[model samples]
Target: MKWRVESSNMKQLAAVLVCLLAACLADKPQPCTSPPLLTGAFTVSTQNEELWQYAQFIYDALGQKIRMKDLGTYDNQSFTHDVLLLFREGVMYEINDLNRTCKKLPLKADFHPLAIPKDAVLLGQVVIGSSSGPGQGLLVNTWTGDIGGTYMMTVTEFGCIPVTTVQHTNKFGWIMTSFFNNIIGITDPSKLNPPDFCPDAMTEDVTREPADFWSLFFNK
Candidate 1:
């Protein structure tokens, strides 16, 4: 009888341990990297400025290459451009479609992958939409950290797909919020290639760091 009681107690303890392990796994943060190529649309807004654009981005970590094409309107001005950041070559190409020109300049920064920083602190987890029914809501994770500036990023819990990012820089005295939507994998690899006209483009003597999507419009 004592042997049976002891065995039953051991089984109960094992069941409780299993439940605790499952709970811990469920709450663990899962940081993820984005796809190598993606196309998406985003809107960035600041105090008195707003920019909307469609973006095709390529991120090659192994080769240390990054390219982005942005066609958009900024503060009522329409602009189309491509920023080819070749880290290995130490050169960046800013191709403007409006004037059909490209400016080659020095690459100021290295490639930073589109993933949650390793030191990012988990802010919270929430549901984006209605959770009453199946396929109704998106579970997302919010993370906050400093990367050149203080920023908060929200991404889907399942795929780590970006939903929004808010960045603030005290040095620049600006706070920008961006919303991303309709994100999908890149359909054509050729779209990542530098424009044909870039070979004969002029080399500019500017020594400024490359601008991000929001800064590009904000500075204009």
Candidate 2:
């Protein structure tokens, strides 16, 4: 009887230790890098505004390029276009499919990685769904910081997949939220290439800052 009691107490102590260790691991910040090549869909919306857009995106971090095809209703008018940013070439191409025309502008923004910034403050961690069973819930971390503007981001804890991002800028009165979905590794490398018409794109000689990219879509 005495031996059994000691063994039971040891088991309980070991269980407690395991729980503490797990808690510590979860609390520790885990910074992760996104996959080099990916394709996804996202929705962007402005706060207190009817303006919204749904876009399919192809990202090639390794090649320093990204492309977005979007259709949106702004001010009750439907519009569609494709924007391609080539970091290496320092240029952006805005393509109008219906007119078969492309406008080329200088893009000075550097490539920003999808991972959480080192200076970002962790807001909290939460589960999206039920955490009671395996494969039931997605654990995610929320981070906030100023990157040109105030921004908050939520990403999956395990794979560091971006779930949503909210950005605000006081100077521009801009508040936008974006939600990501259907993200997967890029299957066709050719999808990252600019359209054939881009070679003959008309150059727009307007000076643009990096932040001007967002303003291009939100000009109401």
Best by TM-score: 2
For all candidates in order, the CA lDDT equals 0.70, 0.77
Q: Write the per-residue lDDT of candidate 2 for residues 1-220, one digit (tens) a residue.
A: 9999999999999999999999999778666677777788888777646567888889888888888898887767888878888889888888776877778887767788777888889899899999999999999899989887888888888777888888876543455655566466877777566668776554765655655556555543
Overlapping backbone residue pairs in candidate 2 total 0
lDDT of 2 at 189: 75
Lowest-sum lDDT 10-residue window in model 1:
211-220
Q: What is the lDDT of candidate 1?
A: 0.70
Q: Write the per-residue lDDT of candidate 1 for residues 1-220, one digit (tens) a residue.
A: 9999999999999999999999999788766776655556555554444455666566565566766776776668887767877778778788776777777777656566678888899999999888899999989999999987888888888877778877776434445544465455556656456677776544765646545634433443
What TM-score does prediction 2 earn?
Answer: 0.77
What C-alpha lDDT, on a 0 to 100 scale, does residue 96 get in candidate 2?
A: 76
lDDT score, candidate 2:
0.77
